[model samples]
Every structure is written in C-alpha cells, then in structure tokens.
Target: MEQNLQYFLIPFLNWEMMLLIWVGVFAGIWVGAIPGLSVTMAASLLISFTFSWDINSALALICGVFVGGVYGGSITAILLNIPGAPAAIATGIEGYPLAQRGEAGKAIGLCTTVSVFASFVGIIVLAVAAPVIANFSLKFAPRDFFLLAVMGILLIGSIGGGDPVKGITAGAIGILISMVGMDPSTGEMRYTFGNIYLMAGISFVTAMIGLFGVSEALTQFRQAGLKSPKQNLDRIIPSWATFVKYLPLSIRSSLLGVFIGALPGTGGDVAALLAYDQAKRSVRNPSRPFGTGAYEGIVAPETANKGAIGGAFIPMLTLGIPGDAVTAIIIGALYIHGLKPGPMLMIETPHLFWMIVSCLSISSIALLVLGLISVKPFAKIIEIPKEIIMPVVIILSVIGTYAIQNSVVDIFYMIGFGIIGYFMRLYGYATGPMVLGLILGPMLDANYRRTMQGAEDQFLPFLQGFVTSPISLFLTLAIVFLVFSQTAVYRRWRGIQ
Candidate 1:
C-alpha cells in the first residue's frame, strides 16, 4: 500500500509533470472547442512531440488532454449548437437551447460541476473495480462485440430528432459509406471502384468534420439575420442546492458512462448518448422540456462523458485493449516506450497502473479549475459574428480533415459530406444517427466476419454461439431487452407515454 501510494504521489510531487498536465488541459480546451480537432487528434499529436520525453511525463500530458478535451467538446455544443465532438451531440440538444435563452453561464457551470463529480466516479471505479471489469471484458467473444455494435446502432432512436424511418435511412447510408474501402481481413477491394485513395478507406474523422462542423457552418448561413445569444456570466459556478438537485442523476449516468467506456470499441460518445436517453425517460419533473433547455439533459451527458475518461483507461492499462481512439494512441505510446500493455502489464509494472490512476485524478481536478476559468471567454466566442466565424470554421474543418492523413482527397470528401449533411438537415434528417453508424460500422463488420469465420461459415453455429457463451448470451438478452424497451407497451408500463 505504501509503495502504491508512492507511485500515485510521484506526479503530484514532480513540478514538470504537474505543469505539463495543466498546460495540456489548457491547450486541450481550445483544441476540443474547435470543431473537427478531436481529443483523439490531440493525443496523437502529443505522441509526435513527446516521444523523446520520459514515459511518465508524456502520460501525464496525455491524461490531462484526455480529460480536458472531453469536457471542452461541450463548450461549443452549449454555445453554438455544433457539437465539438460526437459525445457532445446530446449536450447541444439542451445546452444550445439554454444558450439561446441567455443562460449559457448557468448551464455550463452546472455541466462543469457534474462533470468533475463524474470524473471522480470513474476514477474510483478504475481504482477499485478495474481488474474485475477487465477480466469480464476479456470474456467477450467476437459475436458479443458484434451484438454490442448492433445495440449501439439502435441508439439512433435516441439521437434522431424526428422520423425514425429517416433516421434509419441516414444510418444505413453511413454504414454503407463505411464499407467504401478495401476489406481488411480478406484484402479485397470493396466499394473502392479502382481509386487508389478509396483503397485506404475514408477517415471517420474527416466525415465527422464535414457532417458536424462544415455542415453546421452551411446551415448557419441560412439563418443570416439571427444574432448570437448573449451570455449571463455573473453566476458561472453552481450553488450547492443546484448541485444537490442533480446529484442522483449524475451518479447514475456517470456509473453508466464508466461501464460503457470500459467496453472495447465503445467510448464516451455512446455513453453520453445513452445517458441522455436515460435521463429523458427517467426525469419526470424536469426544469424544462427536454428539447428546449433541461438541466437534466446537460447533467446526464456531461457527467457520462467525463466519467468515460477514467473508464477508457481501465482496459488500456489492464488488458491492452483500447477503450477508445485516444486510448489506442496511448497504447502506441506505451509500446514506443518499450512497454507491453496486456494482462501481464500491471503484474510486471504495477507502478504504471497506479500512476495512471493518479494522473487522471489530478487531471480531473485541473479540468474543474481550468474549465470554470475559461467559461467566460468560451461563452464570448459564441457572440462572434457568423459571417466572420463561419468561414474560419470551414477553414478549420478543411485543416482538421487534411491533418488526418495529409490527403487532399479527404478535404474534397469532407466538403461533399458537408453538402450532403446540409441537405439532409434541411429535409429533417438528423446527422447524429449517420455519424453513429459510421463509428460503429467497421466494428460491427469486422467482428461479425471474425465470428462467422470462427464458426466455419455455418449459420447455425454462428447463432449457437450466442447461447453457448455466457457473455454472448448475456449481451444477446440485453439486446432483446433494449429492443423491447422501445415498444409502446413497455413505455406505457413505465408510465413514459
């Protein structure tokens, strides 16, 4: 215990490490607030610059970026209705409305308070329950992952603003688009159409930039006369009563976030969306109607996404499996530093695990202080003229898309997606489901194919695996329950309708 305490205290005692974490958090806020410049991108960039640094300092910076970036995404979502990251999509549903009503300060303040609380929730879970969750996750089969992807696809109902059919259409289109490149497992061209660039497949980041960032820019052009919302900055921190009012919901949503974040190929985006849906269904006496400006809405998603920060680290530290793209990059950093990250990683290098837990805890604390301090400046950005900001936003989108692979083709593709997203939004189709489909499509396809191969391409055997494997059976049942919960009868039973 004393040795573990030493590992945890190392970062707190090192001024250089502490400074890097604070700097990373500050930089991450700006980066994440800019659409298309995602947490994954920031962490990847850190790797290039920090490769020669000691592993501990590098990790401290990355941890700060991870925590701060996740929270920073909400800043734009609340202020401009454009989600800086997919995880913030649900935040915008309520947050942007609050901003429009000139309550951006209160909304953001509450979000920060709950987010910090949830980050601690995730850290505690990581410290206490990580090994158990890691072992349990290891039991998940390929079929189970495929099932999980299917469950994620069903979340279109939650994210889609209206018209389930249109949502399904958009989501299906996204899934199809995800198949545009060569097949990874079979090494065969899919929808590549003989284009060399197509063979590498589309970067989802580029699509996200187009769909959420540039598309939002184009949509704003149509609302030319609309002025940006004025913010109330006097009371940017929540009162104890306000925090207490939402404590229960924060706890529930945050725990859900931690679990979802620990899932491989899943991350804060899914967790936030799920938490939002759960809050919408569960909160009976909301401060306001959900779509307009409900505090419950912001609390659920912000807390969930923040909680996912610690959750993402659990699998990375224990099982070598990345919980999300940011963690995947962190895995590469570990490898570059001559460290293996599998089950033996913790047993052989116990200090690394404890140190990560410590760093994430410190990062969360930094996020609260830095996040609150930036609220006024961030809120002010919302007041910028659309004519000036929109063009800059588009340029940022172009740059962010290009940075993914330094490809000009991706910029064109991003522009094309932006155009499509604009038209779709005009036609009442929400972009959220489509992005969800794109994110989960590859995971679904790869896992399904692997499971099928394991079953020797026999249909019956593939189905049987769901019943044969305990983990697969549990997931299958959960999927069934999820489907059932969507029915009118179930809603009626829960008194939701």
Candidate 2:
C-alpha cells in the first residue's frame, strides 16, 4: 500500500504532466462533444503531438483525454438527443428526458459523478485483477477470438434497440466497409474504385465523423431554427438521497463496464450498451418506463461507460495488446519512451507500470472536478447556430482528413464520403452500419486470411473446428442468434409470456 500510494501521488507533483492532463481533458471535451469527433481521431492527433514528450507526460495527456472523451460524449447526449459517441447513446436516452423535464444540470452532474466513481472502480479492478484476467485471456485460441468477434456483432441489438433491421444492416454495412482495403488473404484490392488513396481502405475515424457529424449536421437542417429545448441548470449536485437510490445501478453498471472494457477488441461503447440492455431487463418497474427518464436509465450507461476506462488499460499494461484504439496508441507512446511491454515488463519496469495505474486513478478525480466546472459552458454549446456550425464542421472534416497524411486526395475523399453519408441518411438507412464496417473490416480480413493460411487450402480440418471447438461453437450460435433476432420465432421466444 505504501509503495502503491507513492506511485499514485508521483504524477500529481509533475507540472508538465499536469498541464498535459489538463490539455487532454479540455480538448477531449471540445472534440468529443462534437458529434463527428470520435476519441480515436483525437488520440491519433495526439500521437504526433506527444512524439517528443517523455512517456509519463505523454501518457498523462492521453489517459486524461481518453477519460474525458469517454465522458465528454454524455454532454452532447444530455444537451442534444444525438450521442457524440456511440457510448453516449444510452446517456442521450436517459439524459434527454432530464433535459426535456428542465433538470439538465442535475442529470449531467449525477452522471458525471457516477462516471468518475465507475472509473475509479475500474482502476481498482485493473490494479488488482489484470494479471488474472490476462492469464485467462492468453489461454484463448483463434476460435475464442472469433467467438468474441461474434459477440461484437451481436451488440447491434444494443446499437439498434428500436430498429433491429437498421442495426443489423448497419453492422453488415460496417463489415463491408471494413473490407474496403486490401484483401489480406489474396493480397487483392477491394472496393477502392482504383484510386491510390483507396489502398488504405476508408479511414474509420473519417467515416465516423462523416456519418455521425456531417450526416447529423444535415439532419439538423430539417429542424432549422429549432434547437433541443434548453432547461434550467438545476441543482448541479444530486441529493444524497437520490445518489443512494441509484447506487445499485451505478455499481452494477460499473462492474459491467470493467469486464467488457477489459476484453480486447471490445470497448466502452459495447460496455455501455450491454449494461443499458441489462438495466432495461433488470429494472422491473412498470410504474416508470425507461425512455421517459428513469433515474436507473441515467445511472446505467453513465457509470458503465466510464467504468470501461480502467478495464481498457488492463491488456495494454500486461500483455501489450491494446483493449481499444486509444490504448493501442498509448502502447505506441510507451514504446517511444523506451518501455517495452511483455512478460518481463512487470519485473523490468514495475515503477512505470504502477505509475501508469496511479495516473489513471488520479485522472478520474480530475475528471470529476473538470466535468463540474465545464458542465454549464457545455450546456451553452447547445444553443450555437447550425449555419455557422455546419461550415466549421465541414472545414474540420476536411482538415482532419488531410491531417491524417497530408494527402489532398483525402479531402476529396472526405467530401465525397460525407455526401454518401448524407444520401444514406435521407433514405432511412442508418450510417452506423457503414461506420461499424469500417472498424471491423480489417479484423475480419486479417483473421480469416490467417485461418485459411493455417489450413493450407484444405477446408475439412478447419470446418471441423466450427462445431468441435468451444469458441467456434459459441460464435456459430451467436451468428445464428444475430441472424434470427428479427425473425418471428426469435422475437416470439424473446417475448415469451
């Protein structure tokens, strides 16, 4: 405890580290609350900025942004019905109700508090349990990874709560988008339309911005001059009684967040959605339905999404496998600082490991303070005019696209993709499928190719594992469930009296 406490306190005394953390926190909020700006883009930008900094300072900045970005999303969710990040989708459901009811301050405040508490809890879990979890995860084979991928696919239900078809279609589209780059197995180009820029496939971050940001901006034009109604900034603090009342949900969601976040390839979005679904199932309240603004709804995803912070760091520290894109970047930062991650990392650089964990814990406290101070200003951004907003968004989109590689073609690509996203939205097709496809396309490509390589053109032995391996069996079942989720039989089964 003494040694751990020392590491925990060390980061606080470093002024350079502190400034970076603050920069990350505020910047994360600014970008993350913008509908199109995802954490991945922000982190990607940080890679260039932090190239010259030492590991600790760089980490402080990145981790602070990561924490703030995850929570910054809830600001937009509460202020507008649109979720800044997919994780905030649940927050919007519960938070928008609070906003509509003229209690925006309390809703934001309570979730902010809950988010911090959940993040701390996740850190504690990571500090205590990462090694055990990593050991178990290491035992997982290719079949297990495939099963896990299937689980990610199944999350479309959570993503498409009201419209299962839209969600599945979105996921399918995301898969296709993911396939845009080179064919890993055959080394062939796909869906590139013969452009040299298409060689890298679509940028997932760019697509996320176009789909969520640009498309959403266009959607706002439909309601020109109509803003999401603003509410009085009520008591910023939830009453102790109210806090106690939702404590159970907060704790449950936090635990759920950590578990899902710790799983490699799954991050806060899935954790928040999973906990949201679980909360909906567990809450037996016929008196107040979820969407109409139950406190439990507010508590569930808010806490869980924040809870994923600690969980995401587990694999990054212990196994060097990033739990998410943000953590993946952090891994790169660590390498730049001359810290290598592997089995010997624990023994070789125990102090750095402890310091990283400690810094994670500190950022949570910092987020709570930062969140409260910024909530009022954040609420004001809701009133910003769209005419001014869309132009700036388009500019940022162009700049962000070009910034990725100083490529002029990417600017054209962003504009063209933005148009595609806009048309897709107008026709009632969700852009989510395309964005998801962008994220997962490479995973499917690489893994499927590797699987084939092992089989050496012989398909029978590989086919045998689909049923025989526990992981493959689980994945196959998940695919079946996902495919049949919209069918009468599955719906009937799920809706059984």
Each prediction's total of clashing residue pairs, residues at least 3 apart in sequence or on different chains, is 0, 7
The per-residue C-alpha lDDT of model 2 at residue 420 equals 77
* Local accuracy of candidate 1 as per-residue lDDT tens digits, 1-497: 99999999999999999998998888888788776788998999899999999999999999999888998889888987778788998899899889989899888888888999999999999999998987777777789889888888988877777688899899998899899899989899999889999999887777877888888899999989898877789999999998999999999999999988998878998899889988887787889977789999999999999888888888988889998899999999999999999989989999999989988888888989998988888788778988998898888788877877788999999999899999999999988888888888998999999999999999999999999898889889988887888888887888764
> What stretches of model 2 exceed 4 Å from their correct place?
13-20, 35-54, 80-104, 161-163, 225-228, 280-282, 286-299, 385-402, 405-427, 448-497
Q: Which ten residues in a row have the lowest lDDT in candidate 2?
A: 279-288
Residue 180 lDDT, candidate 2, scale 0-100: 77
Enumerate residue pairs that collide in model 2.
170-433, 174-433, 174-436, 174-437, 175-437, 178-437, 178-441
Please write out the lDDT profile of model 2 over residues 219-264, one tens digit for every residue.
7788777755665775787778877878888889998898778778
lDDT per model, in order?
0.88, 0.73
- Structural similarity to truth (TM-score) of each candidate: 0.95, 0.83
Clashes of 2: 7
Error of 1 at 265 (Å): 2.2
Query: How many clashes in candidate 1?
Result: 0
